[model samples]
Target: MKKPVISGNTISIPSNQEFLADVDLFIEGVLRGYEIDESVIADIAISVSELVNNAICHGNKSEFEQSVKVCLKWINRKVEIYVSDHGNGFKFESIDSPIADENLMKEVGRGLFIVKSLMDSVDFKITPEGTTVVITKAIQ
Candidate 1:
C-alpha cells in the first residue's frame, strides 16, 4: 500500500483503508493546533474518517491506483474539510435514510447520516473528474 502524502493543509493517499489512521492523525493534529475543543475535534475527526472511508470504498472502489485527497482550511470561526476521490461521482440523493426502520438495523449505511448530524454543513461537488465532499464545523 502506498503511504499518505502531506503538503501544507492537504493530504493525499491511495485508495486503501490502511491509510485511514494517517488521515485521522493529521486532522486531529491540525485541529488541536487551532485550539479546538476536544469534543468538537472528535466530532470533526469522525466526520472526516467517514468521508475518507466512503471516498476509498465507494467513490474510488478501492482501486489502488486511485487517490483520495483531504484538504483542511479555517475560515472565520469555522473549519472546512474537503475530501475528494478520483472516480465517478455518486448521487447524494440516492442514499437511504439510515434511521428508517428497515435501515436502522443495518450497520453500513450510517456514515453519511452520522456525518450530517455531527457537522455544521455538508456539501457535495460532483463532476466528471470526481466527487469532493465539503464538510464544515464551527469552532467557536
Candidate 2:
C-alpha cells in the first residue's frame, strides 16, 4: 500500500482505503489545534471518512495508481474540507435516495446523505480532471 503524503494542509494517498486512519489522524489533530469541540470534531471526522471512502471506491474505482487528495482550510471559525479523486466524475444528481424504501436495505449509498446531515454545507465540483466534494462545518 502506498503511504499517505502530507503537505501543509493537504494529504494525498493512493486509491486505497487502508490510509483512511492516517487521514483521520491528520484531520483530528488540526481540529484539536483549533480547539474545536469533541462532538463537532467527531461530526467532521465522520464526514471526511465518508468522502474519502467515496473517493477511493467510487471515484477512483479502487485503482491503485490513482490518487485521492484531501485539503482542509479554516476560515472564520469554519472548516472546509475538499476531497478530490483522480478519476472520471459521476453524476451527483443520479444518486438514489438512501432513505427511500427501495434503497433502505442497501448497505451503501448513505455516505453523501450522512455527510450532508452532519455538515453545515456540502457541495460537489465535477470537472474533466476529477471530482471534488467540499464539506464545511462551523466550529463556533
Candidate 3:
C-alpha cells in the first residue's frame, strides 16, 4: 500500500483502501486543533471516511496509479472538506434511495446518503478530470 502524503490541510494518497486510517487520523487531528467537540468530530470523520472510500473504490476503481486528494478548509466557523478522485463521474441524481425496501439489503449506494445525513451540506462537482465532493459542517 502506498503511504499518504500530507501537506498543510491537504492529503493525497494512492487509490487504495489501506490509507483510510491515515486520512481519519489527519482529519481528527485537524478538528481537535480547532477545539471541536468530540461528537462533532466523530460525525465529520465518519462522513469523510465514507466519501473517501467511495472516491477510492468507485471513482478511482482502486487504481494504484491514480490518487485521491482530500483538502480541508475553514470558513468562518464552518469546516469544509473536498475529496477529489480521478475517475469518470457518475450521475448524482440517478442513485436509488438506499432506504427503499428493494435497496435496503444492498451494501452499496449508502455512502452519499450517510454523508448527507451527517453533514450540514454536501455538493458534487463532476468534470472530465474528476469528481470532487465537498461536505460542510458548522462548528458550534
Please tell me which predicted candidate would have the highest lDDT against the true structure.
Answer: 1
lDDT of each: 0.94, 0.92, 0.93
Give the TM-scores of the predictions, in the order they appear: 0.97, 0.95, 0.96
- What digit string (tens of lDDT, one per residue) describes model 1 on residues 1-140? 37799999999999999999999999999999999999999999999999999999999999987999999999998999999997777777899998999988886899999999999999999888999999999988
Flag clash pairs in model 1. none
Better of 2 and 3 by TM-score: 3
Per-residue C-alpha lDDT of model 2 across residues 15-52, encoded as one tens digit per residue: 88888999999999988999889999999999999999
Model 3, residue 30: C-alpha shift (Å): 0.6
For all candidates, the clash counts are: 0, 0, 0
Error of 3 at 94 (Å): 0.9
lDDT of 3 by residue, 83-138 (tens): 99987878878999999999999978898888999999999899989999999999
**Once all C-alphas are superposed, what RMSD does model 3 give against the true structure?**
1.2
Residue pairs with colliding backbones in model 3 are none
Error of 2 at 74 (Å): 0.3
The superposed Cα distance between candidate 3 and the true structure at residue 103, in angstroms, equals: 1.5
Off by over 4 Å in 3: none
